[model samples]
Target: MIQDLRGANACDADGCDRALTEPQLVFETDAGRREAYECPCGAVTITVARPESSR
Candidate 1:
């Protein structure tokens, strides 16, 4: 299942001018949780948040 975790202000991609304040698509995996942020320039930035227990 995919979810939005919220807390996004803008696109993190370089040379992109997209103003977005919505949460990214989140996916849970064995490695960790992944957040996919979309940019207006057809770019997608993915960030992973691992559990503290695993670290």
Candidate 2:
């Protein structure tokens, strides 16, 4: 089963914008994870792999 993670830090492609507030659960997939931010203008982002050292 896939574990659901919430409020992970995310940023836009430009790297100029970062999620100011916690992200809401949107969905998850094998390719990556998706989350929605509080900002209405915000776009969904995919989460990459977790750091090996962190595990």
Candidate 3:
């Protein structure tokens, strides 16, 4: 789980920061798998694929 110490985007008035929570989901595709995190500001950040050995 992700932690939000400053109430999700404490720096901005709209509270659209992506670092406030964990990624929405972990997906596996033909190309690879990644964790997707989205913010209220329409910013989507995808982490690199996890190692197959770990999965």
Candidate 4:
């Protein structure tokens, strides 16, 4: 099952909820992982929460 655990790390604070454009590995944590995205206006970061069942 596909689940979206995206947070409010909204990109393009200007006026666009830019999706993860240039998704690059940013970091990882026991909770989940993070990826950085580049928007024409700026950059944003998002993290996915790991499901308890998977761990």
Task: Report how far residue 40 has shifted in candidate 2, in Å.
Answer: 7.3
Residue 20, model 3: lDDT of 38
lDDT of 3 at 46: 55
lDDT of 2 by residue, 1-55 (tens): 0133342343444544554455566565655545554544555544354334554
Could you give the candidate ranking by TM-score, starting with the highest?
Answer: 1, 3, 4, 2
Model 4 C-alpha lDDT per residue in residues 4-49, reported as the tens digit of each score? 3233334647677754444555566776665655566765545465
- Alpha-carbon TM-score of each model against the true structure: 0.56, 0.32, 0.44, 0.41
Error of 1 at 51 (Å): 0.6
Segments of candidate 3 deviating more than 4 angstroms: 1-20, 28-33, 52-55
lDDT of 1: 0.63
lDDT of each: 0.63, 0.47, 0.54, 0.53
Q: Give the TM-score of candidate 1.
A: 0.56
Clashing pairs in 2: none
lDDT, candidate 4, at 23: 59
